[model samples]
Target: MRPQENYMVIISPGLLVQLMERTGDGRSVSVRELADAAGCHPSKIDALRNGRREKSTIDEALAIAKRLGVDLLVLWEHTGRTVPVPAEPPHIAAVPA
Candidate 1:
């Protein structure tokens, strides 16, 4: 079987709570509403908001970010062991006399 790539979307609980207070309409959105928009359960939203959880799937993060009318970076950050890039090889240029 092919190996699957696993990624964790780490969110800022404090920032999430703050953003939820002021949506695009300048009104607060409920947990249930946000959950519906995020295609998850209200408890999940509550857990994240209350700092009971910190990690989420990419889809949930995107949906929450979209509903909040902000970029994904605003609320979540992608952190993990990065694959290092190999050093570039030397390029030889031929010069004409």
Candidate 2:
């Protein structure tokens, strides 16, 4: 993968910041450190932290939630975040006469 070309996950910066403040163990962590721990780029973390992103993959979200000691579903719900996945259409098999 090329630099700055990684698939970044979107997330709610406000919610994340809230969670971090509430649960960050009183430890000040940098964006680069968080990104390193989350297996993403610092820009991705910064984007999510600064309200520049809106969506995130399950893995990334889970990692972040774990770091903040918050439940993924709970945080997602609090953030008003919804999955962008389209509902799978029902399959209809053709019947031969």
Using TM-score as the measure, the top candidate is 1
The reply for model 1, stretches above 4 Å from the true place, is 1-6, 82-97
Model 2, runs deviating above 4 Å? 1-12, 22-24, 77-97
lDDT measured at residue 25 in model 1 versus the true structure, 0 to 100: 68
> Model 1, 3: alpha-carbon shift in Å?
5.9
Pick out the ten consecutive residues of candidate 1 with the lowest summed lDDT. Answer: 84-93
Listed in order, each prediction's TM-score against the native is 0.73, 0.59
**lDDT tens string, model 2, 1-97?**
5343112234456767776666657665567766776788887777678765555556676777777776776565322234343222244223546
Model 1 lDDT tens row, 1-97:
6464333454568888888999866888889999999999998899788776666667888899889888888887764666222222234123546
Q: List the residue pairs that clash in candidate 2.
A: 10-55, 10-56, 11-55
Q: Mind sharing the TM-score for model 2?
A: 0.59
Counting clashing residue pairs in each candidate, in order, gives: 0, 3
